[model samples]
Target: MHDRDQDIIVCRCEDLTLADIRALIQKGYRTLDEIRRISRCGMGPCQGRTCRALVQRELQASGINIKDQVPGVFRPPTKPVTLGSIAEGAGRRSDHA
Candidate 1:
């Protein structure tokens, strides 16, 4: 592959390049979840919102059939949560007990 392609930033949140992902795939980290756990590619602020598709594309280019490959689960609170809300919820729960 060309240097430009390798240097392509797939996950900007983690500053990961395509080469980084390719290396992970070659090491048998084929699934998105596996790569995420090891390289922390999509575990960023976007939570794969931006990088999931890119990761899938990379996997496909590497000859992996991603049609059945389930992407990693993305939990809620996609944005930052304030500590005050957490404390308030905890207090309410304690009152019911």
Candidate 2:
């Protein structure tokens, strides 16, 4: 592959390159979940929303049928909740009750 293609960013959230993905595939990382877990590809703020398709495409190109592959597990973003907010919400609920 050309250097330009290698330089292409597959996962912008994690700054992972196409070359990185290819290397992982060559190393026998077949499932999307495996790749994500090992490389943190889909563990970024955007989750796998951005890179999932791109990585899948790569996997397809490498002769892996994505349909049968185990998909990566995406966790919901963790939002920080202050204790004050929780207490205020509880107070409001009590007032309503």
Candidate 3:
């Protein structure tokens, strides 16, 4: 992660750079909530499964308080499903795997 290549991509959906996030952290934007609100980090399709932890650690290294930082909520299904994927007649899929 040396130097983050100076131009490394961070939030791939929004095309935000590590440099941009770091600059935000260097200012007073000290929480994941704050970062997301202002910089739009984890509001993308991958849903922070990739970038959330990176953003969290980066902010923490900058002295942010993450213990109470309030990561986003997880709603039902918790996995993606298309409406067509739902079956009219169904027993749930087996867990045999």
Task: Show the lowest summed lDDT stretch of 10 residues, model 3.
Answer: 88-97
The per-model lDDT (C-alpha) reads: 0.87, 0.86, 0.74
Better of 1 and 2 by lDDT: 1
RMSD of candidates 1 onward, in order: 2.5, 3.4, 5.6
Candidate 3 per-residue lDDT over residues 1-97, each given as its tens digit: 3477358777887778888888888787888778877987877766666778888888778776778768766545566676666652243554332
Candidate 1 residue-wise lDDT, 42-91, digit = tens: 88887888788988988998999999898677788868578899899999
| Model number with the top TM-score | 1
Clashes of each: 0, 0, 0
lDDT of 1: 0.87
Ten contiguous residues minimizing lDDT sum, candidate 1: 1-10
Cα deviation of 26, candidate 3, in Å: 2.1
Better candidate by lDDT, 1 or 3 = 1
Tell me the deviation in Å of residue 48 in model 3: 1.1
Clashes of 1: 0
Clashing pairs in 2: none
Q: Among all windows of ten consecutive residues in candidate 2, which has the lowest summed lDDT? A: 72-81
Question: By descending TM-score, how would the candidates be arranged?
Answer: 1, 2, 3
